[model samples]
Target chain A: MSAGTDTRSVTRQVRPGESPAGPAAGPGKTPFSARLRRDWPLLVMAAPMLLLVTAFWWIPALGNVIAFQDYNPFTGGILGSPIIGFTNFAELFGDPQFLRAVVNTLGITAFQLVFYFPVPIALALLLNSVVSGKLRAFIQGVVYLPHFFSWVLVVAIFQQMFGGAGLIAQILRDHGYSGIDWMTNSDTFILLVTAETVWKDAGWGTIVFLAALSTIDQNLYEAAAVDGARRWRRMWHITLPGLRPVIVLLLILRLGDALNVGFEQFMLQRSAVGSKVSEVFDTFVYWSGLRTGDFGYGAAAGLFKGLVGLVLILVANKVAHALGERGVYSRS
Target chain B: MSRKKVSGLAPWEEPGSVAGRIGKGGVLALIVLAVLLPLYTIVLTSLSPAETVNRVGGLVLVPDGITFDAYRQIFSDSVVSRAVLVSTGVTLVGTAISLGVSVLGAYALSRPGTLFHRPMLFCVLLMFVFFPGLIPTYLMVTSLGLKDSYWSLILPSAVSAFNVVVLRAFFMNIPHELLDSARIDGAGEFRILWRIVLPLSKAVTAVIGLFYAVGYWNAWFNAMLYIDDTRKWPLALVLRSYVVDSNPLPTATVGVNGFGHVAPPTLAIKMAIVSIAVLPALLIYPFVQRHFTKGVIIGAIKG
Candidate 1:
């Protein structure tokens, strides 16, 4: 297979793209046509990805202009619809349900940041403390298994544990108490979702912290000990600081993703818990737009989410850069 | 947590406290149980007789007479059998397409001096922040006549910006010296990528391949969004309908053993569905677990 390419490649200079040494020499100095001649293969390689992104992402982003129109899918379509600029946004803000969704979405994001974010760090610390590498690896394997499970499967497994007539309910009944259904209760719905999120994802979250932990210089701990610093001192001074960069980066990502609080989890449970508790941003768009056929209204909500998310991500990335860390993307 | 001989504490480390170690062991045990106990009941309930499931009330704890009756019923059910095939086909095709496009694109972006590298990288990185709203994408799909088509599931979500970034990072970390030598040997970029780069990247490639495959296998929302045809539903969607929606499966298909009179419990049948949905993830996890520690950690740390 390689020999087939050797025939055409044998005599052609191919320019080698960049020499190994001083490879950072910017191609910006090269003329576009010359670079094109030398690097057409790379362009060919990237075409499919560029095409897919343009089709699905950029086009649909432009398509959000339907949000400003009084759209009818059948009659007006996207273009023929009469422009009612900002009317959809106006109505969206005025609607109490939309407001509730914003509140709920922010609430979930905040709640998870407080309660769920530290779990993997704590778990990693615990796992890292274990002296037996074999036991640690085994535990890590078992815990990370849940991250691979489909949300549908995760919910089913949770239902078997927390639903009416589920194991906990059964245990309560066996003890002569009438048990409450955990899955359907609107009051503690936040707790339930948090627990479910932790179960499904907290283990996976540990991987980054574990990686960070491994990178921390062990010699610092020895140095600290020789200076008469205790275990708590070593952890407080050395460990947490070492983890700060990764922690900051992840926290920034969580902020950027604040609006998207697990659409499928909320969608699957909407009927059971009522939309009042379950209507986060994504689910709200899905129900209002897709289910009610209010394409314009839904698109407005979606565009609201996308624009706000972009702003948040940009702001967060700026903060990261100020704090001497790379955020979501580099300026390069 | 196990009581095997632990490595002696390093001189810098404080003497281990017995109570703290015991507490850690207990907590770790609970975490493991929290995962395994649910899995145990689901699997056991699927295997148990009707009386055993009924006696336990809903989810079985202790085992009783084991049987393949539930599995037999699930396999024989036409809807489920068809769904399994659909899920398998979609996963295989989707993974291949994603891996191919992502690998090529990532390699392109990996090379620093290549034409349009910055523009291509920008195109991908832009996806990270500005997720176009779901409605327009849906509109685009419908307008393009992809409604109810399997292509709808594969095309729209095929190129993940994160995966592209991760794969690009991995490719860049490859010793450029290796590729330069191949280039000097008159190997074209394609040949170098095929013969040199890919052979060295088996672990990370397999890891990325598994990630895409799992995403495809576990995706139900796309199917729900685009597929109006029940016949085209993947296993994940089918699992959702039966388990989350708690819809009764076709009576003729469920709750009956191949032999006439031995009716397995409905709970067993539901548990059976859950098992079928979950089993693949569990089976594939151990093999991929090492890659998570290696591939995902390195990618994450680098980012």
Candidate 2:
């Protein structure tokens, strides 16, 4: 994603009169002061953004140093704190609660990958197949509505419809059947969360896939039809192949984000199902770091998760490159 | 149902066998029902009379009578009313600041050969891979003494890197010849950006602005983390605490004059809060829905 955007702009920068050597090479050709004079307006425009990013993004990044320190709010600041090396990490790996959180995180991620990932692809195909524009638009709007809702709202809606005293339970009681405890059931917590996620995002997620489907050459489908390809066969061959690159790109991105199985969703429902089931890395970090005031320990767990995410993204990008696709970033 | 001829149906697309048509129709119906049923229930329950809501014991599927008591009660409450104001203020201010920063930065970064452009773009893109984890971010906010301030919410998320990249992509796609001609005609970069680029990029800018607004509106976590003062909380956070946390509505002491007679059911109140939280998005969504696909697709395909 990053590399693709950069390369486009880089190519665009190559003017007719300019040297073939790009902007990076231009620094050597022209004097620094001369270039600065010419680029001052753009620099001035970007200054606020640069300052904001430096404060929010870069400074917090530097604050990751606390992960390696015995961080205390009262006495030692981030850098002033005594270095603790990987002791916090060692403690994190040793803690049963942390292990449980890890297991839960992976479990949710895996479930989402298996069950939730293909849903949007399937939904997009279904929407794509609809010949009626009005029906398609209506369905699209309805589905996308849930995506705009906050997780708290989504969970509340689920509870309203499925909780012990919820609509479904009330209906079942009217028919002399007992109400089910699906909403607060720890055993089914993972499945419930996954279902909620699908309900919320599956339709919205189809936007990109649908866009990809639209870009497929219509002539290929017509030619396939002339060659006697059935609807199912055409979809399997022509349509699926056309969507493969996007599917791969999305898959890599999903894998990179596999560990972040949402904080708010789990946090909101944690009391209902208990932390034993609902606790994930994000909530775990929150509980240990902020809520419990174990900043160093929580920072360590968070840092560990961040590092894993970075490595996963890099590895995913490398795999994408091996598959002859541009990953998130290019080497250039 | 009458079968209307479908436009944009490819020549290769079959009319489909009877079974296939029925199957597709059934699946589509199921998908639509899955989405609409919960929304219907929420709205119905919110509007249902207290007696009907009590009888239902949860969400009212069918309304015996309509009552705006729940809405009146919630709106009249000091806490909720204050929360609404906070949310509105945060969303408007945050969106404006975000749009301003994003527009200026995107324009600067869009021109590739500008000094520090490559490095700035690289810095922005790095956000895609590495996140400064939650603890440090919280520490930073606290250390900066923005722990209880609204600026904490606005500042932390002031500039979305994805939006910036997407906006830059849109800027880059603006015909260079037009910009060049304007430049030759003595129009400065700012003038060209404001007068020409922004005017032409209305669709994209509007969509990105909507995205920022929605994000700010739906945001509760930042407020929950930073703003320890309950009165300063936004609607989403209030909604979460009141509805999801199942806290009883802090009875309105001041504005309960007319609402005192009609004691709405708990379910009705919960649904009403949910509706209030969602109402703004639903109101503006139709107007902006068309741009959703265009905006997201551009970002996905290019960025």
Candidate 3:
């Protein structure tokens, strides 16, 4: 509450040490000794979120301990289960379905990086070239709308357009051709999913690139023009360089999330295409854990996924810093 | 990388540049048309009569034949009507609760000094990069006895890490000078948050709130995974059944048109289902799009 003394000691831990940032640090910026005043209202304000995270996020994180145990939800609690050491990991590696999921996850991620990642940059460039603000904004709005649509709606929309009974198939049948099984065809499922991801997300993904482009000084373009640089040359040398930081930043972030090939997207369509096409780490856990009621085994796979993601983020962040670009986890 | 090469000299070469402008404009127009044409066709197909739709069979590209019969049939069923009501309830209630909880937490994090602020921030960030996977979360929800209830939809998704981070970044942009002034005016942190911070943050709040609302509205997988009760189904799940399973006709007690007969799965029915699911988001999205650039990009840049 603002009713307290306005001065507080700024003896904050720039490093991890000393007292945590709390309402106890008196209201004035002063020496550390006189700062032990409790601010109840501030603590009260911070309580709900902390409680929610601790309950939902932290508790579930702690539940990952089940991965190392022969845990039974019906019998022993998460921590009280018998320890099985590395057997879960051993089992996970030995399972063919799990191996398939690993390969499938990597395969989809690589395909997306190659296919879906660059279109947004091209789109941003096209948008930047459009001199009309109204038109650009309208198009941006139209494209970005799909990002807000849930995976359910997106999958439904795709099915309505391309499924065996969908419009395209209906058209093909009318034209004396066989109805194409685009949705259910396992061979083409990865491409279909990647295309859907682009359609739903690429437009929203352009925002950062556009923001970066907008920040580039217009005078540089004028100078390029004065130097008799062609439009294509100007774009190649100046525009692309201007967008480099954002591109690198986004790439690093994307690498950090490379394994997260989305859950709801794969889940809804997995039944249609069957596991051969749709099985990924997230859905694998969902099915094995919930459907088959193997909570401990699923938790082990999930814990493995989390550790991989964390390692990716950390490694990618370090790589970015080494390359002299600010990663998602900048020191600041 | 193979890039398309420009055919002619730069447009600025020729004065009046009319031909060059027309060429580029023509290409852009065609691109826009290609993108918009499918959406237009879907809407037209949804609007046309069932008989007309079946006759067309594929897509009614032009709107020459049109009727509201499909829309009428879609809204007529109690199952669909109830699902719409439930979806609306969940989205509105869920977004409000999510925003309230996230704003409180984010505001706390944005403040310079709060107990365990850095650790709290780190925890939130950890939620973004490393997830607790579906099994444990499903187990947690089930253990909490929320399986068949609307609370299952509302509570589990009430805290989106991305939205919280975005809002926290937005809140941090608030000048410390303003907080200093508010403190001098004898206002509590809550008063400052409610009166000063929130008033200044309408754009981000509205955009993030819209994101949450759309998320809840479009959520079907969670309901499919956790919700077993047909009565509490959302429009998205209903649409999924219609689209994926291709069954327009309602089950058992519910009648399609208050008759004992079941309507066949027509293109019109499928389109109508998609149209219904998309309507809310399409209608509401433009208003929120204005806030999106500033609201989202700032967060991404900072993060």
**Could you say which candidate leads in DockQ?**
1
Give the per-residue lDDT digits (tens) of candidate 2, residues B42-139: 99998998778777677777768998988887886788889989999999999999999999998888776668877998898788778898999988
Chain A accuracy as TM-score for every candidate:
0.88, 0.89, 0.87
Predicted candidate 1 versus true structure: per-residue lDDT over A90-144, tens digit per residue: 9999988899999999999899889998898899888888777778899999888
List the lowest-lDDT window of 10 residues for candidate 3 chain A: A1-10
Across B1-303, the per-residue lDDT of candidate 3 in tens digits comes to 001222232444322255766666676676566446667777888777555665676667657666666666667667788999999999889988899988888787776554455577777766655677676777788888989989988887788776776677667677768876887788888898899889988998888788788889988878987888888888877877776666645642233555433342367666777777878988888787887776655443543
**How far out, in Å, is residue B229 in model 1?**
1.1
- Docking level for model 3: acceptable
Q: How accurate is candidate 2 locally (lDDT)?
A: 0.81
- iRMSD, model 3, in Å: 7.2
lDDT of 3 by residue, A1-332 (tens): 00000000001011122222223343345443333233445556667767777767887777788888887887887767899988998999999999999999989988888888898888888777766566778778777767777777778777767888777898788889998878899889998998788878777777767877877777787788778876788899989987776577567656767777888889888878899879999989888777787778988899999999878866765564555334222333
Ranking by TM-score: 1, 2, 3
Collision pairs in model 3: A2-B188, A7-A27, A7-A28, A7-A29, A8-A27, A8-A28, A8-A29, A21-B114, A21-B115
User: What is candidate 3's CA lDDT for residue B68?
Assistant: 69
TM-score (chain B) of candidate 3? 0.86
Model 3 reproduced share of reference interface contacts: 0.39
Q: Which ten contiguous residues of candidate 1 chain A have the minimum total lDDT?
A: A1-10
TM-score of chain B of 2: 0.93
Question: Residue B236 in model 2: shift from native, Å?
Answer: 1.6
| For model 1 chain B, the run of ten residues with the poorest summed lDDT | B252-261
How good is model 1 by TM-score? 0.93
